[model samples]
Target: MAGWEQTRRRHRLVHDVAGDFARNGPRALAAWRPAIETEFGGLDDLLRDVQRRLHTAAEARLDALIEAPPADLDTSVAAVLDEVAEIYPDLRRLLDAHASHPAVAEGTVRFHRSVRTATGVDLTRTRSDRSRYEEKGPVRDRKPVFFARLRPVCGWLH
Candidate 1:
């Protein structure tokens, strides 16, 4: 399969495994892991690649933002918000899939904080609204629904 297709399949597998694990528990998950590792490779390696891709994409986005400054702070913040909104779901999926894994769970926490600090956007939030960027105070309190939804998966992993 093509690289993108393979990545897409891997992502689907992770999502499926996570869903099954949620319903069936660790016993079912344990059986699934061998096939998961066989087809998609190790979870650790997959997560590393996912993080690397996200970081590279973030850097490129930041570079673009720097190269062409927005009209004002609102515009700049909005740009970052939009970028994070686009990226967070995939990252959240990878994190959710391997939340039980020690290294990956720690990485997820770090990634969440770093993204929030850098972009002033709460990645944990499930929904994105362009209007939210209009207000300064509300943005800070934004809940990470995406992270919340995946919390159980991590709990199960442990």
Candidate 2:
């Protein structure tokens, strides 16, 4: 086909679509509703997949830290826990939003369990205690309470 002919055809197609939307008004959007709904429905699944990947990576990182004998265990632990602190709020929000989802709940439980195993502190308990104090909602500044608790046992954190 000639280039000009193709351009003309595209212009006609665009005009046709514009005419349909003009005639149909709001009804033009009706065709898109199901696809939009499908996308919205898939968002939960996408979130779940992201959560799972994050948990897996965190768990592996923690395990590596636990297995190695770092010269400065406190600093190493602090570094990893700092990463955890960063992700905790988002993870908590996902948990709250999908509390009914068994997979999300299970992944959260597993992540917390891994943390407890790596650090002596049980974050779930810390979170529960902290939650009681914060009337406004999710605490903005989350300092991993594990450092204070781990200090006595390791004697490395000053």
Candidate 3:
């Protein structure tokens, strides 16, 4: 099937499964869970793949900076930042999709707190700032400039 058709089918499947679960409760959900996973597992897999790729790229970038700092270090750093900027939206989408699930929501809260404690960076604050920009207009207009400014910090960290 075409991609759009597959997406539509999945959408219908989700609605049907949800309706069934609501009407029939836990027993129905238990029966349907495997099918639900079969249909939706690819998304979770894709998110994991993206995360692994991002981690590898980040490590490679950091290694490059440590081994032989480039002449135009800012540009090198910007490239890595740009890669992160590109990948982050997909991660956000996957997380947002699962945010309604109680377990996922609780885990996300714990992870956010851990990150804040470890990195001294408040993800909630950053998310809020990003939201403000999104509300104003297209992020494409601002992303490049924001990443450009961020390059200096990246360089300093290295």
As a TM-score, model 2 comes out at 0.38
lDDT of 1 by residue, 50-121 (tens): 555455554455445556656563345344544443434445444445566776666656866775675555
Compute the lDDT of residue 54 as modeled in candidate 1: 51
- Model-by-model lDDT, in order? 0.52, 0.48, 0.46
Overall local distance difference test of candidate 1: 0.52
lDDT: worst 10-residue window of model 1: 149-158
Worst lDDT run of 10 residues, candidate 2, spans 149-158
**What CA root-mean-square deviation does each model show from the true structure?**
10.7, 16.3, 12.1
Q: Please give the range of 10 consecutive residues that has the lowest summed lDDT in model 3.
A: 149-158
lDDT of 2: 0.48
Per-residue lDDT tens digits of candidate 3, residues 1-158? 59867666555554455455446654655676676677667434433433443344444544555467666644554444354434344333333344555554555466456545544445565543224323543255444532432332122221
- Cα displacement (angstroms), candidate 1, residue 120, comes to 5.2
Clash list (residue pairs), candidate 2: none
By TM-score, the best candidate is 1
Better of 1 and 2 by TM-score: 1
> Over 4 Å off in model 2, which ranges?
1-44, 69-81, 84-101, 117-121, 128-158
